[model samples]
Every structure is written in structure tokens, then in C-alpha cells.
Target: MNKVIEVQKLSISSSQGCIVEELSLSLEWGKPVTILGETGSGKSLLAQAIMGALPRGLEAKGEIRLLGKTVECKADIEELWGREVAMLPQEPWLSLDPIMPASKQISLVKRLVSLLNKPKSESIAIDSLARFGLEGSEGKVPSQLSGGMAQRLAYLCATSAGGRVLIADEPTKGLDSSRKQQLIQLLKEHSNKGALLTITHDVEVAKALGGEILVMKQGKVLETGCCESVLNAPKSEYARSLISARNLDHQRGDLLPNHKVLLELKGVEKSRGGKTLFSNVDLSLREGEVLGLVGDSGAGKSSLADVVLGLVQSDKGSVVHHQVLTRPKMLKLYQDPPASFCQSITLAKNLEDLCKLHQLDRKDIPRLMSELSLNSELLNRKPDSISGGELQRFAILRVLLMKPKVLVADEPTSRLDPIVAGSTIQLLLEQTSRINCAVVFISHDLELVKQVSHKVVKISDYVANHSSELSSPLVTV
Candidate 1:
């Protein structure tokens, strides 16, 4: 194997401070490497640096070699990007051109590698799509495709062209288990041709790749070794902590005796655009009880949540509530906290405005922030300046001030690392338990569901009673 990408004493710094400290890495042909870290650990920064795509105002100092070629400037390195190196961005759907169809995007990549004509490129695009189990989807734009499908398309664009070094950033972020496995296989196949580097928070992905693993934290590599040795027997305490935090063997106590029903849905039916989303669904949530909802993406779990939160009404059937429901009394924590906040304003302004609108006391804000282990100074920063996990913790603090009877959290930890996600879920449980708030937890991770939920329900089965149903099985824990 030959060295494809080599970095010696690489450092990246921004106006605030040094984001990535002195780091060194080497990836060789026919080998795959993964960098595992919590959010804001500078993993993605290194990826961008390797591809010469660093953010504006951030500069790199060190030596980077791609296939024995050295470049003096970032532009010089990027000149060789499309032909010698490729990157699969963090968000495939967003990275893809919204106006262009999938077929056109694939064709463009083919044209870049080989000056293929329109008809020939289109034919290759169709055949490539079929290889990824995405046959007949060439005409649809990224918006019309699901997250899994879009990720597959992104993989195609990166690898189908002639590139020797591939950098994948959280490639399996929103995929289900089956799609994730498929992605791992595809990565393996690509590694056979060239060097592969994966940046992710997913432990399973790191394990499946069966290659060298770098455990990073706060821009430094804490440990490095082969997959089996490093994960099963990590050398650093931080690495050990990360593995222990993802453990899902916690015991749940028995349900509260004579528990009061907080929220109930009976025979709920919802439809849109002459298509049935779900029908004949029933769910019950008792006070102090965590009810886990498991299903594949776009499986009507979010729609059911909308019905419960009164954001959308069911076409048929009913949503019954024993307790009085108000804007503050019932709150929903969104999947993406950045979307929830006004990006232009600082967190302090957002909090102040939210308090005024909800008639919440200003004094309670700092107290909840303390409980969630959030720094008060962070409140002065903009949402964009904070990490995703930290932003989610901020969102949790906002809802805690309301002292709601029930909390509906949708994919709260889907984008987070296992350790951070575990801690966040535990904090939510601890706080909500103190208030005896019923929780409706929706997620794709079944192991986490089993550890947290008092009772688990499969949305696939509930919707199967309708005319059209989910094509997957009812996974329960």
C-alpha cells in the first residue's frame, strides 16, 4: 500500500483561538481510517484541511501531501481536489444542488472525471443508481428523496469519478441500521481502490470499518490503534469513558402505582395529499413514565407527535388529555435546535424574548441552566457558535422553565455522539422525573430506547392497521 494522504504537525486556527492542535495522520491505499470524537472536536476541521476546503478566516500550518504531491497554497491543493481527492459532505441533501435532479448531478460528476457526453453520462447514472438499490430515482431532486437515498447518491458522486483519496463526514448520520450496513459495505468497496477516511460520532460505524481508529477530543487525538484492540481495550481513560457512556444496561424501575394518564391518543387517523400517513393509532402516556416510540424515518412518528402536541389535527379519531394544555404547559423539543432559534440573535436575546412571550419568570432561567451543566456565559453566544449537544441542552433548559406536564422529544440525540447523547438523555430523564412529567420519546436507536423507556411501542405496527403500512418490521426492546 502507498500513502495517499499524509499530514505532519497539522494545526488549524481561527480568530478565537487554535481549533486543532498539532496533529499528524497518514492514510494509505487499500486502508480505511476513522476519527471518532464528540461534536466540536475538530474532526471535520481536519477533513476540510485535507481537502483544502477550510472555512474562511481559518488558516492551517503544517505539511500535507496527497499522492507524493506537495502544494504551497490552499488553492493549489484544491486544484487537484476533484481529480485526485473527493469529499462526501456532512449533510448530503443540503450539499446537493436543490434545483438539479439526481440524474443531472451524477452525470456532472461523470463528466468531470471522463468527458462523457450527456446521453452516455445519463446511462451511467441510471446504472449506478440501480447498483445502490435506488433504481428509477434519477429524475427526483434531493428534496424529493429521503435522507438514506440522498446519502447513497452522495456516495455515488464521490466514488464514481476517479478519485484516489475519499473523505466521508458523518456519512451515515440519519440512516437506519440496514442502510448503515449498506453504507459500510460501500465504503469497504471504495477502500479497496484507494484510501478512505471517515469522520463520525458513531461507534458502530468505526467498528464495522475494521481499520485504524483515532479517538479525538477537543482537537487532540487521545488514542490510536487498530479497531478491535482500541475499542475493546482502550488505552486512555477518556477513550474508556466514551465506551462506558454508550452502555445501555441501565435498569428501569417499576411504573408508578396508580399512575395518572397525562396524554392519550385513540384511533388517530391522519392523511395528506390524498395519501394516508397513518391510521387507527392508539397511545397512552402516564405521568412520570417514559414511552418510547420506535420506527424508521418518515414512518409517521413525527406526525403522531404533531397530533399529540396539537400542532396538527387528526383527520379522524381523537386526542384526549386529562390535564389542561397550554402553550407553556405542553412543549416540544425539536430535532434541530438551530432551526428552533433565531440564528441572527444571541442566545441571551432568544431567551429573553421567549420568556417575555411565554410570561415566564426571568429568574428561573439561570437555575435550570445550572442544573443542565450549561455555562451561563454561553447564553451570551449565538446558537451557531455552540455545539449541537450544547444547543440541545439549551433547548432543554428553555422547556424546563415551563414546568410542563408532558414533554414530546423527537430524535433528540440522533445527531449526537454516543457519550454526549447518553448524558443528554439521562439529564432529561432526571429533570423530568423530578417534575413527574410524562415523556413521549421518539428515536431510531432501539438500544437507547430499551434502556430509557418504561414501555416501548412500535409505530410500524400501529400504522399497519390502515390501508397502507410501513414496509419494515416492528422493532421493540
Candidate 2:
């Protein structure tokens, strides 16, 4: 293996605290390297540092060499970026220009492609989109595409840019199993041609890619070794815990106790403009059971969540809670942290406002902050200033403070690292247990669905197959 990227004594810090410290690693050409950590573990910071795009006020101290050539730490580094290395951010919407068509965004990367090879720009763009499963999606804008589609488009742009090094931050965050497999295959193909540095909490993805794996904790590298060695027999306790958590999530039947039905949806039908999204859908959730919802994008999984939260009116049917019906009083969290928060407001203030809206005391903020392991100092910082994982924790805190009888979380930890996702799930489950609240967790990650939920619902296929009898309970897994 030939080293394509090398980092020596890499350290990154922000006003809040150190993001990464003395992180030294290497990526070999035609090989895949994975960086694993929990939420708030600075994985994104590490990626940004490599691309010389760290946020303002953050400082870096390290040596980074690409193809044995040292990269200068100057403003011109942005010029070197995209050509030498391309990045796929966690949220594709953030990377894309909302006003521009998806095709134009692909065209914008033409300069970098031209730098590498003089292929027809339009042909290359079309080919790249096809490879990413976005064929014929060129006419759509970023806002028009679903979360999964936008993510795939972003991957296409980054990979098509002809960068020698590709850095992906949670590339598979919002994708379904089928699309996940496709993306993984695409990443494998890319790795066979160039070096890949994947930052993810997905152990399966890391294993499937099969390469070096680095585990980081609290801004430090805790373990680094072959993928199988680190995953199967981790040396560090933290690494072992991560593996254990993932295993537990996969083996839900063994870890969770089956209970009687706690909530039931009968003949749930929803539609818009006379086009049925989902109809006659019947589902039941039991106490202490995690029900995993799996389906393609625009598959009505989110619509189902909305109906449960009383946010959207269903055309017909009824939602019955075995205990008591709170209607809109149910606590709900969204997939994207930004969607659930005010970007201009400090985390603490946002939390406080949530409390106030619910007629709660301001004094409860500190206790909630401590419970979620959020730094109290972050209370004053705007939502945009915090890490994705931190924002997720804050969102969880806001919901917990409300102390609703039911928690309807829509892909709550989709953007977090595996460790952070596991931790967040564990925390939510523990809280649910303590409060004895019924939870409705909606996500596209099947593995996560199987791990957390007692029953699994295949929404898209179910609706398609049973349109005439949507009231009947579909296959129960």
C-alpha cells in the first residue's frame, strides 16, 4: 500500500474547546480509511481540517501531506481543495446552492474535472449522476429533492470532481438500505481508484469497505487497526463499548422485553390533492418495544410521523393511545438538527424558550443540560456554532424537559456517529423507561430499526402491496 495522505501531530481547537488533538494517521492510495467516534467527538472538525475549511475562530496545528507534498496553511489552500481533495458534508443541503438546479451544481465541479481529464463536461456530469442513482434528476433543485436524494447528489459531485482524496462525513446518514448498498458499492468503486477517508459511526459500512479503522474519543485517537481486528476484538474499552452497543441494537429481540400494545393506529389514511400517500394503514406499538419504520424517500414514513404527532390531519382513521391521548402535546424531534432549532438562538436560550413555552421554570435548564452532557457554557452560543451531535443532544434535552407522555422522534440520530447514535438511543430508551412513555422512532436505517424496535414496519412496500386492505396490520417483524 502506498500512502496518499499523512497527518502528523494534528490538533484542532475552537473557542469552546479542543476538537481534535495530536491526531496522526495515514491513508493509502486505492484503500479506504474510516474515522469512528461518537457525536461531539470532532469527526467533522477532522474532515474540515484536512480540507483546510475549519470554521472561523478555530485554530489548527499539524502537518498534512498529500502525495508526499506538504500542504501550506494559507488562504490559497481553498484553491487546492476540490482539486486535490473533495468533501461530502453531513448535510447535503448545506453544500448545495438552493437557487441552482442539481445539474448546474454538478457542472460547477467541471473545472476540477477538467484539471484531471478533458472529458466532455455534460457527459461527465450525466454519467456521475447516473452512477449515484440520480439519473434524470438533473432538472430538480436541492429543495425539491428529498434528504436521501440530496445526499446522493452530493456524493456524485464530490466523487466526480476527480480529487485524489475523497472525504465523506456520514455519507449514508439518511439513505435507506437499498440506496445504502448502492452508495457503499459506489464508495468501494471509488476506493479501488483513489484513496477514501470515510467518517462514520456505521460499523457495518466500515466492515463492508474493509480497510484501516481509527476510533477517536474526547479529541484523541483511542484505537487504530485493521477493520476486522478493531471491530471484532477491540482493544480499548470505548471501542469495545461501541461494538457492544451496535450488537445490542441489531439483536433487539434479545435485549427488549415484549409487552402488550400501548398505542394502536387504525385505518390510518392520509392524502394530499386527492393523491393518496398512505391509506388504511394499521399499526400497533407495545410498551418497551421499539418499532422500526423502513421505506424509500417520500414513502409516507414522515407523513405517518406527522399524523402521530397531530401535526398533519389524516383524511380518515384514528390514532388510539392505550393510556391517554395528548394530541399535539406529544414531544417530537426532527431528523435534521437545524430544522428543529433556531440557527440564531443559543442552545441554552432555545432550551429555555422551550421550557417557557411549556410553562416550565427557567431553573430547570441547568439540570437538563447536565443530564444530556452538554456544556453549560454552550447555552449562550448560537445553534450554528455548535457541532451536529451537540445540537442533537440539545434537541433531546428540549424534548425531555417537556416530559411528554409520548416521544415521536423522526430519525433523531441520523447525523450522529455510531457511538453517539448508540448513546443517544440508549439515553432515550432509558428516559422512556423512567417516564414510562411510548416512543415512535422513525428512521430509514434498517439496522437501526431492527436494533431499537420490537416490531419492524416496511411502509413503502406495505402500502403498495395492500392498497385495498390498508386497514389490516401488515407483516410484523
The numbered model that scores best in lDDT is 1
Candidate lDDT scores, in order, read 0.77, 0.74
The residue-by-residue lDDT of candidate 2 on 416-472, one tens digit each, is: 766667667778877765665667778876656656765667676445345432222
Q: Estimate each model's TM-score.
A: 0.82, 0.81
- The residue pairs that clash in candidate 1, if any, are none
TM-score of 1: 0.82
lDDT string for model 1 (36-96, tens) is 8876678877887887777667889999887777644667676566567888876564468
lDDT of 1 at 21: 92
C-alpha displacement of 6 in model 2, angstroms? Answer: 2.4
| TM-score, model 2 to reference | 0.81
> What stretches of model 1 exceed 4 Å from their correct place?
67-74, 80-83, 92-164, 249-259, 271-277, 312-315, 327-329, 361-381, 466-477
Off by over 4 Å in 2: 1-3, 15-17, 67-69, 72-74, 99-101, 111-131, 135-144, 247-277, 283-291, 310-328, 417-420, 433-438, 445-455, 467-477
